[model samples]
Structures are given as structure tokens and as C-alpha cells.
Target chain A: MTATLTQLIPLTPPANPQLQDIRTQAAAYLQEETIPTNKNEEWRFTNLAPLLAQTFAAPNQQLPPVNINGLVIPEAPDSRLVFVNGIYAAEYSSIANLPAGVFVGNLAAATDAGLTVTNYLGKQPGGEEVFTAINTAGINDAAVVWLTKDSSYESPIQLLFIATVDDAAVAIQPRTLIVMEAGSSATLVQEYLHTSIPNHPYFSNSVTEIWLGDTAMLNHTRIQDEDITAIHIGKTAVSQSQHSSYTGNSIDLGSKLSRHNWEIFQIGAQTETNLNGLAMVNGEQESDTHSVIALTKPHGVTNQLHKCIVDDRAHAIFNGKVFVPQAAQQTNAGQLNRNLLLSPTARIDTKPQLEITADNVKCSHGATVSQLEDDEIFYLQSRGLDVETAKILLINAFAVEIIDRIPVASVREKLAVAVKAFKAS
Target chain B: MINPNSPVILSIENLTANVDDTQILNGLNLEIKAGEIHAIMGPNGSGKSTLSKVLAGHPAYTVTGGKVTYKGENLFDLEPQDRARSGVFLAFQYPLEIPGVSNLDFLRVAYNSRQKHLGLEELDVFDFDELVQAKLDIVKMNPAFLSRSVNEGFSGGEKKRNEILQMAILQPSLAILDETDSGLDIDALKIVANGVNQLSNKDNSMLVITHYQRLLDYIIPDFVHVMANGQILTSGGKELALELEAKGYDWVTEPQPVG
Candidate 1:
């Protein structure tokens, strides 16, 4: 690692002793790790040169005055957690009316509640990865969500992360750890956003780890809509127990360059997982999504659909892996990556990998990259729609399949509007 | 319904077209006046579908020769969408299942486009809903289908009914039915044909292209034309459809001795 990049890693002692051990271990591991480049197989299609060349300072301590008029989700009016540049903003948060057996707070509040988060925090596999290690080593505070055994939270919990760069390029590592106990159920909406500022750039590295216990269910919706000048890299690691259900809907809309690594591991039998993701990019932006679903037990079921709409000269890359070992006999897994290139220069690289060792398992994977169909366009034209409107309608149709699955009504409507307004140019 | 005094709605003279380097329409000639219903019957590979596609301005088909005039104006002057907005409609044999586009939305947009082209005020959601509901009874379609994707997961009969419903909504001057009865059952054909019959008037015209005399039973036409090798070979009354059905296409397509 370059000395300049190494100097950016924060080694400040955590205020709470509970994080000292993990921080030290992660910091030691960070020394041996370096920022990944195109040489890395996982990052072959994503060039990190821009991110590596620019220097990033620590997050600003003084929060900026902002207007979040439209950033709030109505469904979670009283259960929202707001963070600015990775630091918890208590004044902007509303934590009232939460049900019993639920704890939603920052790391300091968790310590006060006598919550033992270390048992599940940073415990998911892939903690040794470079960016993950960097986030772990620099952990000062995190958004923590904990649901006790058999607890049910009817309303969705919102975690909003906002970033701003007024002067220098700042870097922030936002951490989220969600633990759902046995038979518990809850819905979560995590959003990463930034103001519409041009030329001013920032870097955001985020890590989220979720644990679902036996018979638990979780509905997770993650949205990344930062400014076009920002660089973002995020990881979401999930572990599912027996009979647990996990459904994730992720949308990537804004960023100059971004990479998202989503990994899921089924540790027990009869687990169910459904993942749907859409990455819509334009301009000269680049977006990469890498996902892995590893099944270790029998009778596991997983279905994944990841789509990308590349417009202008933007580029999109998707690599989805599904592993079904011998122990995962009778596993049913389906993975499909569908991409739409709106312009001649727009590019999409998709790879669907299925490693099946069990003969009895039913697993299927496929990838398709296509532009608009002439027949479809002509069909719409025959119905009185002009060529431009027909293309927009078809593009919206391609995205609505994933957007409609979002559980939150406001989010779905907002995304639908954005998708409708998108143009190829 | 034929009226000699009525203005000519469509006139096709020696229209030659090709799709993917293969000539599909070979100097085809046809003319239809307002308030008239014409039925064109032909055997397989006779360019029946190609003629409709060319009239609708499908991009894959290139016009190599001849010209088509609609409402006394050259039809080729307008784009496909403009042709549709100007009252030319084609009911596809295989309706596309456009997933994620609601039937109601598609109908509203299409109806509004035609309304705008006619310099009429566009209907809002509420008003369009009321109008579409009244039109739904024409085809006896369930209102639940309006909320679903356009033609998606619809049965063959439902798709044909949907096409007829579109024709009823558009109220086109020159409506072309391109094998509309190809995938329908006996019951579906009756319902679809009944819808088309209800929409027919002295101000509009229809060109029904079919392979069977069965659809003609429900939608009786003023003129019936037999087509061969991409051109119309004979023109007769409605009984011509019955003769073709009974005697088969062999009698018409067979080479006659020099006479």
C-alpha cells in the first residue's frame, strides 16, 4: 500500500473498550492488506485508479446545515436513524414508539443498554478483505439494530447515511450491524445519499452485516444514490439459519464509480433467500455488482435476479456465483443476470457462475445482454406511441420488475418516477 | 355497407414490399371506400400478413415500389405512429406480451395520442377509466385484466379480445385485422367479431384478412378477394369465401389451360 493511502487509515482509539480488541485485530490485518486494483480477479472489470490516486481526509466533525425534506420515508416517520458522514446525528433522529425487545441506536447507546454486539459484529465471513478490514479498523460508531427472540416489528426501520464535501475530499466508513433473534421478524430500509453538488468529490466505504436466527424473517431494502462525483464501495454480508427467510431489494442509481459486494451464506437447512438488484447508470459512470450465494445445507432455496441498464458511455458489470456442495443436496437455486444497453457505446459484462457438486440439486444460471428490440418498438409504434416514448416505456418496463418488489410504497413511487424520467442520452 | 358515393378510405396500387431481402408483397392492389368492409382470404405463404404489416409501416418491411393513399393523402408521408394517430390501426395476429406495462396505461396513452392528433382534448385518468369501462363490455372482458401487464399471461382468446377492444377504443378509419382469428376458439371468434361489428359504422372501414370462412360467418363482408403469390387474383362477393372454403384453395391456385 502507498504511504499516503496508509496514512488515511484512522488509528484513533475507540471511545468504548468493547470495540478495542476487534479494532486492533483489524488494524493489524490492514497493515498486510492493500487497496485492490484491476489485477484482482474480483475487481478485474472495475478500475480503482481514481480512488487510489486522490487523498481523503477523515470525516468532518462539524455537520453541515441541510434540508432533508424529501429524504424521509413516511412509513418509518418515528423510527428513523440519520447519520451525516458516518457519524450518528442524534438531533435529526427519531427513535420513539419502538416496540419492546428491539434496540436501535449507535455503538455508545448499545454499550449503555448492556447489549453484546461483538458476538455477531464483524463475525460474518470475508472480514479479512481489504476494504472490509479498512472499515473495521476505523470503526468509531455504527448503526446497530437488534431484535430479541420472537420479537416482531411491524414498521420498517430507516437508516439514512448522508455525505457532503464542502472543501477537501473526505472519506467515511459507515457500518451497520443487524441481528434478528430466533423467530423474530422485521423490515429495514438503508439508504446512502448525497447532495447534488458538482466537482466536490468524496469517498464512502460502508460495511453491513446481518444475522438471521432460526425461523426469523427479514426484508432489507438498500439504496445507493450518492452524487455523481463520489466514489462508493459497500459490502453486505448475511447469514441465514434454519427455516429463516431473507429478501433483499437493492438499487444503485448514482455514483461516478461504485462497487457493491453482496454475499449470503445459508448455514442451516430449509432456508429461503430472494435477492433482486437493479443498477441504472448513465454518463461516464461505472458500476459493478458482485454477489455470492453459498449453500451448505440440504433443501435450501435461493432465487436471484440482478439487472443493469447502461446508457450513454456508462459501463456495468455483474458477476453472480451460486455454490451447491454435496452436503446441500436437493438445493434449489436460480440466478439470472439481465442487462440492457441503451446506447452503442454503453457496455455490460455479465457472468453467472453455478458450482454444483450435488447431482440431486436443481440449479440454473443464465446471463443475457440485449438492446431494445425492433419488434417491440414497432409494436408500440403501432399503438400510436412515438419512437422515443416507446423506448422509454420499454426501458421503464425492464426496471419496474425489480422496483415493484420494493416493500415501501414511497420508495417504489420515487424510483418509478426516476425511472420514467430517464433518457438514453 | 358499401356506398359508391362514400369517400375512398384507402387505395393501394401495385404496392411491392420486402422483408429481409425476401419480397413479401408483389404489386398488390386494393381499394376500400368508407362504410365498406373488405375480406381478403389467401392460402399460406400468400403475403396476407405482409400486406397488413406494410400498411402499418413495420420497420422490418421495406417498400420497394408503388404507393398507398389513405384518406386521399399519401400514407407513406407519415411515420408509423403518425399513421396510427391519423386513424390507421392493425390488429396483430400474435400480440406482444409487454411485461410491466399495464393494459389500462397502454390503452390510455394510445387513446390520448389519437385524441391529440384529432385536436380533441385528452382524457384524464378518471374520464379515461369511465370510457374504457364502457368499452370493456363490448368484448365482455374482465376489469381485472386492466391492472395486469399488457397481453401478459393472457390466453389466446383473451389476447384476441384485447385486440378487438383496442380497435373499439381507437375508432380508426382504416382498421386492418391481420389474422385476428388465427388463435381464437369458436366462442372467442364470435365475441371478437361481435365487438368489431359493434364498432363498425358508415364513417369507418375494415379490411379483414383471414384463412377461414368461419370468421366471415360472424363478420360478413361486402367484398371478398382471393390472394395468390403476394397479389390478389380474384374479387367477388361474400359467397366467394364459402366457395374457397368448400372447394379449397386448389381450384383457385391451379393453372388453367390457355383459353
Candidate 2:
């Protein structure tokens, strides 16, 4: 039966120009690589049987209409961008008073404007994955943002990517590219929201690539909250230059089966990067987040912290790796993963690894999975808080270390509300 | 019928509690009325802190046999939160540090819980800020403390004062101070004691548990009870603390005449 099932699995076909350029490229790559079965290192804890069983229809050709009023930012409203199914919707987007020489728009349009699209597209590693290849191939539209040298955008740019589909078993791939020129600084928020009812099966595959030039700084926040029956696979790659700083905050709250891959490369000296992530899973949800920070240059620093809260029969997995090459002397890197299991049935698998060949580098990695502290809960309850309220409070606090670092207040408030609602549900 | 004029708000009858199957508070009995402060003094392992834990409904310690009545209600019948909402507070000896929960949010939730239990309208952020600020003054704590994570990096004294701040905000009918003075310096003790004093009223009572009488010096108690071997050996007026302070707890735990 297993052999028959394996044989029955459909393999992605070779690239054909007749097909959508994105999809053709993805299918060709997928055809060359093996499907990630349980034997694969990354797929050991996650099963793909459920996803393979369903027939996924491509995203609708015509963009679905979205209501601008529904995209309210409680704190900052003027600095926001709206997108539906990977296509930028200019009518709903608002970006007031952008800095000089800064360009932000749809990737296809940006390519038409003579921007360097081919130089950065598909440049990050791990594009060999079938889901990534599918995303590359099927991407209908994408957000392309470029910041010129010496420019600084005071207000954060909020990108609201909403997935709306009336049809069943549909899929959407949203690609995003952010490029910061030398001596530039900016903060950007990318939020993935799904407005679908429970038990409505859908799929969303997304890829984001970020490039920072010399002496540039970038603050990036990604919030993912999808429907319960959706499958989400997201990947973000960041490349930093000399004296450049990059900070990433990723929060995952929804999706039946979700996985996020974060790969950061410090290729220049004096580069600093901080990667922080938090995931809250409940019910039968299974979420996995894998992150890698490589320091290939001297005098670079990197810090990574990821936390997870698993409840009910949910499962969470975290794998963090820090690599310091031999020439990357004076490198400093640290990784920590903390998991809180609310129920005995809930499971969490965490692995923190550090491979440092540079003797002068300081590298450390640690992972811990623990339940809510009884003493802390008792302390709160003693002050009039009930068990539920106390638990919520503790969980919120546990996630705050990363949420509070969000550069955008409006996005932060939305995240806070979402957390409260999750606890209530 | 319960007497409205009665001074005692809490009455323990043959209370026995155990931790990990070992008896701590063995057949202990004590009483404290409103407007009066009582201190429980004992050596280590004498179950001074265990009494406070039992009163607060800590799950770690099991009450083998006994009854604790607060305000004419069976204290053990209510859950920890219910006990708290019913105006029973335990100021822990070691205050926990909640790294991500801001002090303001923690206080607001605690305040709202009490209000909800009382069927009163919950205070909004504006009113809660005002209320918390007013209480902060009593403890001499700075307004900056509100924005920080609860006891995340606070000093020993700050933690104790934060505990008192919560006690003041909750305004419980009975406050149990379990070793509140264990790690405080002179100034922090005074500040914490002053906060407690400002909150105590004619309708509320306090139980101060300590190994030293120095804490009672600042927030003087009206009654002093010597607890040894899990039972109250003696109870007397304020001067009894001075006597115990002079002669030490060994003097009281010695064989004494039964009344």
C-alpha cells in the first residue's frame, strides 16, 4: 500500500514557457528534487499526507474586491498598503509623504519601471522546496519596495495581504521584495490575514526577500493569522551588508498546518541582526518555524529568540541554527527557543544548533520546553485573577518580549487584539 | 449568628496542612478580628508560611484536617481566585517575576477581577491609571514602574513594595503578609509597612507572618501569637511580641502550663 501510495503521488513537471513563467520555473525545479517524505530532516515532525490528498486550484485570475474600511489601523492609518491575493490594490492602499527616491509598488510594475528584478529574484537559498517552487511559479503579483541611499522613512510601511476566495480548495502565492540602498533606514510590516470560515480548506504559499546595503537599517515585522483549515508555508530571506542592521519579528497565530523558514545571511563586516519570533497554536493546529543565521564576515553579531505556546492537541516545532565560518572571527551569535505546553496532550519539539569554526567567535544556543509556572499562576490568582485570566495574562506576557518590539504601533495593537480573541476562543 | 461588632475576621479551628505527605501546620488554631493586626512568629519549618499558603488555597499543600473561616464563610470551600475575590490576599514571601506582563496590565486585571466579583462596573483604562497612580504614592513607588514587566528586573525591595501595591489595590478584607520582611532593608521595610498601614481600615484585618519582630516594629500588630510545631503556643497583647523579641522563640516553645 505504501509503495502504491508513493507511486501515486504526482511529481511536479518540467519548466515550460507556455505555462505561467512563475509556475513553470517552480514545476521544473520541483520535478528535479524528491518530495520531502518523513525521511527528510526538515519533514520528520510534519506530515504532508493531508496536503497531498487535496486538489488545489490556482488563485482566481481576477483579483477579488476588498473593502478599505475593513483595513483600519487604530494607531497609524496613512502609512499602509493593501493587497488581495498577492496583487497590490492601490485604491485601498495609503502611503502619505514617502521619503525622496523611495519606490514601493507591485513587482511586475516595478520591473516595467526598469528596476533590477532579476538580480534579486530567486536569489535566496532553499528555493528548491516544492512549496517555494510552487510559490515562485504561481505568484500572480508581489510587493516590490526600494529605498534609495541617504533616505529615511519616519513612519512604518504597513502591508496588509488579505486572502479572500469564494471558491473551495484555492491557493495564493504572495511574493515580496524589499531593497534598502546604502545609508537608508525604514520599518515595514507585512500582515497575512484570512477571512474564511472554519473547515474551508485553502492554501497560501508566500516568499519574501530582503536586501540591505552598506550602513542601512531595516525593521521588519510579519504577522500570520489564517483560518483553521488553511495550510500556510512562508519563507523570508535577509542579506545584510557592512555596518548594516536588520531586525525581524515574526508572529504566527493561525492555520491548520503552518511552517515558516527564516534565513539571514551576514555577508559584510560590522553587520548586526536580531531575529525574534512567537507562535501560538491551539486545537489540532501544527506550526513549525525554522531559522538560520549565518555569519560569514568578521565582526558580525546575531541574536535569535523564538517562543511557542502549544495548547490542546496542537504541535509546535522550532529548529534554529547559527553558523560562524572560519574567516568570521570576532562573530557573536546566540539562539534561544522557549516553549509553553498548556495541555499534556500538546507536543513541542525544539532544537538549537550552533556550528562555529571561528575560535574567536562567541556562539551559544539553548532550547527549553516547559509548562506554565505554577508559582507564577498562583501569584496572579492570589491577587484576584482566576485560572483562565491568569493563564491568558501569563501567555500574553510570554509573547510580549517579541510583540513589544514591533516598530509599528497599529500592527502591534492588532496583534494584541488577536491574542485576546485567541485566548477567549 | 456572626457579630458585626466582633473584632476577629478570621478564625482557624484545629487546622492541619501537609506538603509532600509531611505535616506542616499540625492542629494549628488562631484568630484575628477587623481593625486589629496579628503576627505569627516561628522558626524555620515551624509552618508559619504554611498557614498563609493554606489560607490562600495553594495547591501544593493539602489541608489534612481543619477549618479556616473568613468573614463567616468556609475559606477552603472557595478556590484561590474566589478566596482572593472574597477579600483574602496572601503577600508571598518570594514574589514571582512575570517577565512579559506589564505592571499596569497585571494591576488592571487584578482590580477588574475584584470588581467583577462584586458585580460592580469595571474601571476603564483612564480610571484605572488614576487609581493605580494614587496607590503607587502610598508605596512611594515611581510612575515609571507601571510600564515595566511585572517584577522583571526589580530589586528585592521593589518586589515587596509591588506586592503591597497589589494588596492595596485589591483591598481585601483579610491580608496575609507571609514573610514580607525577609529580604527588605530598612527603607524598603518602612515603605512597604507604610503602604500596608495606609490600606488597613476598620473593616479589614492583617496577619503578619515573620521570623523577626523587626517588621512588627514598623507596622505594629495588636496581637502576637507564637506558632511552634504547627500550633499556636500562646496569644497575647502587643507587648507579647516585645517579650518574644527579647527572650527569643525558644522561650515560648518551651514546656508551658496549659490553660
Candidate 3:
């Protein structure tokens, strides 16, 4: 049996036609784009050795059976898509009462049917991002939802992605495209969870691209609370046209090494965008978030606020940048990052950058990192609470501003429960 | 029928303190009985404020010599929270503005700390709210202020009122009002003094440290001591305050009688 298993393993690279072709293409891409080093500006302060050292493997073709009961959203909308190991699970999905001309299906099926895949696929710029390139190349299947022009949907479409394998290293590349045409409005929720047992190691690489036409509105929410042993890299790119509005609230709770990237481009005038996020990390976990908002046209407005609470030797990093072009007169942008360190060893590094070439624009950016105030703690302790209780109350109050901004009540409640439990423990 | 031989509630003996190596309290000595209101009238740099802070365990002040005893216990051995829980209250001259801590929550914690120190059952949220609301009337404070952050965006009078409100809820045995009347308008001064007077009983005593004698008019003290050069120059009845207000500290501060 040992000899047979050894013979089954390829001596060099697989000789199968499809496998060989894929390896050759991947090798060529890897050669063209060398791994980023410390000298690279975008990769500064972020060491990628943990990600680069891992052996990459494709997602399993036959996904293991998963229970959808634990993944249900109370009072869920008519349309929902569930994906496991980058493959769509139709038995766990629902798309009832979808409006006419709305398209919701798998990316592979949409491409095979000759749907408009080229218009949105790979449309987002992944400049100097090797992980994004790898995700783009490894894209096997994805969930794509497109709304027709002048159509509004009352219920939000929910997408659930779960990773449930233990120790057997796997990579999940979930690509999503949400297009809202003129006069259309909708909400999209993208949730990621890990059902794997404790101490299991996995990787999740996901990219979502969103496009909004004239006068369209979209509310996007992304929640990541996976097992602490998993590594995650997620990217969200949005493009807004004239008079369009796009808002996003992202909450990241669990992961051993997690980094989220958000990039928004305002291509037309009078576009509005609001982005908010909260990251809670504890127990040696590290979470990093990077965001860039670019105003390419005049009369664009953008606001962003990101808060982080790091405890128990955990570290959090936030880098936010806003750029206003020369033609983007009257552009208004504001960004702030506030962090609280609970333990003495917990660390937070925040940098807010603003680059404006327009003279008539209003732009401001600020970042602050500090421990809880002693006076505040004493004030609480003086009331009857112990020192630990006082610290928890003040820390919770610090995070309340960001948590209250979550639009989804159920998700907000879930996040609150996680925070309370974390504090208790 | 007051006990003339009763044990002292608080006694400071030759207490010398320094801030960043600059000596502020140079061998200061003071004492308070269980039911008496003692007013310390002093000029600038007389260490009146330092006395209040050293008792409250403010981190900035260092006691180089001497000791402070509260209810027969050494005050220096206790942390600030412990001292506070043991019924030692300091009404700050300038209360800090904690932006996110609610006023009601602040009072509740203070009240609970005392209860826990006394080994009593703690009050629930509903009961705590009711208790705080009842005490708010002592300071003539608005109920809306309870929802706001502690001392945040408050006027000078409002901050002082909030301090007294905390005192009423905590019900400390020995309260130190550190220049609490400095920034108050006439109306606010009356309100604060009245609140302090209401909270004082036979079981609780107060040490009023002030530069002017205006506050003593409302909360009339049983004994008045003139503090000069960090030591009590003289101690007398309430009439001593009238003398200080009329002639100012410069007059009595020069070669006066000690008794």
C-alpha cells in the first residue's frame, strides 16, 4: 500500500493534459510577477512569508456534505446562494420570487451559457497584487447576481460561503459580481464562516467586484468570523457612475491571519460612498485592513471610519488613503481610524493618507491609537464595578459607535454576542 | 451631647508632599472629627489643594514624609480605588470630562463600590437608576444630564453639581471638597453648598478647602482653620471665617494666635 501510494504521487509534475496546461500557465505567471519584497511600497510593514511558504492546492471537486441549518438567516430573503469549497450547493440555495430579468447563478454556468461575463469578470484592477492574480487564475466557480435596469428589489440577497475541511490544506476562490443598473436598488450580504474543527488550517481567498450604473444604490455587507486557524485574504472593488450611491459595512472577527482590501473608484459626478468597518482580534490573531477611495470626477463625496480593538498580544493594522484628481473639484472625503489596545502587548498601527490635486476639494484624514483612559476606568470602578468590568464597559462603549452603524439587525446582534462573549472570557 | 473625646475620623500629621520635586505641602497637619465640618481658608500656594489630592491618592503628588490616617487606618497603604471604597471622597476642583462614560453609570459604579466594600448586596440596574434619580434632586441637577457622558461638555456649575451628586450617591464618611466653589457662579455656589450641607450628617464629616469664605456662608462650618505656608496658623469657630473674609489672609496670617 505504501508503494502504491508513493507511485500515485507524481515524480515531477502531473503529465495529464489539463493539469499540465494549468501548471505551465501558473508557472509562467509566477515567473512574470515575482513575489513582492520589503522594498515594495504597497507591501511595506506586511510580511507575506506565511502566505508564500504554504503549499497551494486547488479546492476539492466533491464537497463534503454540510448542514445548512446552522447557516440560516432568520427571516431570510427570497434569493440566497450557498457555496462550499468554491462550488455552488444548489440544494442549500434559494432564488424564489426573483424579479424579471434578474440573473443569479454560478459563474461557470453563466459563462457556458454565453452570458455577459466579460463585461464584469477581471474588470477590476489588481495592480501589483499577486494574491489577487492567483485568485483570478484559480477561479473555477463563483456566484454572480445581476439586476436589470429600473428594477428595485425589496429584500437583500444573501450569499453564504463555508469552509469545513481540517488539516488537508485547500484554497477557496469565491468571485462575486453585483451589478445594479439605472434606478435600481438592492442589498447584498456576503458572509464567510468556517465549520472546520479546532487546530485545522485552511486558506480562503475571495474577491468581489461591484458596479453601479446611473442613479443606482447598493448596500453591501461582509462578515468574516471563521476559525482562528484559517488564513483569509479578501478584496472588494466598487465602481459608481453618476448620481449613484454605494455603502459598505464590513465586520472581521476571527482568523489567524486576515487582511481585507477595499478599493472604490468614482468614475462619474455626484457619486456618494460610505464605508465603515470594525475588527476585533484577540489571542495572538493578526488582522490587517487596507482601503483606497479615488474620486476621478467632480462633486463626489466619500466618508469612511474604521475602528479596531486588539487584545491579548494580538495586532491590528489599518491603512486608509483617499485621492482626489485634478478634475475632481468639489470632492469631499473624510477618513478616520481609531484603535484601542486592551493588553499592554497588544499593538495597533494606523495610517490615514490624503492626496488631493483639486483645489476646491475638502479632504481630511486622522488616525489615533491608545489604551483605555485611566480616569475612565477609575470612574467606572468607583461606581461598584471591578477593574476588569470597568475596562470592558469603556471598551464596549468605544466600539458601540461602529457597531451601531451595521444595517443588518441580525448580523449586528450576532456581532454583539461575539463581543460580549469575548469580553466575558 | 457630641463626644468631645471622640476618635478622629481623619488625621494628617506633618504631611509633606511634592509634585515633580517641588514641595507643595510642607509639614501640613490637620484633623477632622466624625460630625464636624472643618473649613480650611488659605491664600495661594498654601497647600490647601495638595492636602485634598494627597488624601484622594492622586498619582501626581508624592508624600515624602508623614502619614494620613482615615478611620484609624493608614490611608497610604490603600490604592485609590480602595481608599475610595473605604468612604473617602474627593470632589475634584475641576472634574475631568470622560466623553463616553454615562453619568448614571458613573454614579452607579461609585455607589456599588461602597456597597461592595461594606460587604453589602449590590443594586441592580433598575434600583441603581432609581437611587441615582433620588440623589439628583440633592444637587438640583437635570435628569437629562444622567444620559450624557460624565462631565462632558458641561458648564462649570454643572460639573460641580455632578461632583456633589456623586458624593450624595456614594455617601462617603469623610468628604473633601477641593476648591469646588472656585468656578461657580453665585447661583451655582449656593446650589453646591446646599447639596454639601444636605449630604453631611452626624456619621459623615467634611473638609472644605477654599480660597474665599463665600462657600462657608451656605455650609457653615463648626470650626475654621487658616492655612498658611502649608501649616494651620490658627483654629477658631465660624467667626474666624468672618475675620478672614473681612481682613483677608494677609492680616491674620501675620503673627496671629494659634488657638
TM-score of chain B of each: 0.98, 0.95, 0.95
Which candidate wins on TM-score? 1
Q: What do the candidate models score in CA lDDT, each in turn? A: 0.91, 0.83, 0.80
Q: Please report how far candidate 3 places residue B55 from its true position, in Å.
A: 2.9
> DockQ score of candidate 3?
0.31
Query: Which pairs of residues collide in candidate 2?
Result: A22-A137, A23-A137, B7-B33, B7-B34, B8-B32, B8-B33, B9-B33
- List the lowest-lDDT window of 10 residues for candidate 2 chain A: A1-10
| Candidate 2, chain A: TM-score against the reference | 0.91
- Order by TM-score, highest first: 1, 2, 3
TM-score evaluated only on chain B, model 3:
0.95
Runs in model 3 deviating more than 4 A are: A1-31, A65-81, A89-118, A145-158, A187-189, A282-285, A310-314, A341-348, A417-425, B1-8, B11-29, B59-78, B109-127, B228-231, B250-259
Between candidates 1 and 3, name the one with more favorable DockQ: 1
Summarize candidate 2's per-residue lDDT along A10-41 as a digit string, tens digits.
Answer: 24441222235545566577566654788989
Q: Point out the higher-scoring one by TM-score: 1 or 3.
A: 1
Q: Best by lDDT, which number? A: 1
lDDT minimum window of 10 residues, candidate 2 chain B: B1-10
Q: Considering every candidate listed, which one attains the maximal DockQ?
A: 2
Per-residue lDDT of model 3, residues A1-425, tens digit only: 11211221223543222234433444446446655666886667566666666664665677778887857676456678889877788888887667685767777656654567657766775523666656655555578888789888777678898888756677777778887888888887789887787877777888898989999999888888878978888999999999999999888888888889899989899999999989999997888899989889999999999999999888898989898989999998999899988888888888888998899988888988878776666555444456777676777677767777766677767776777666522
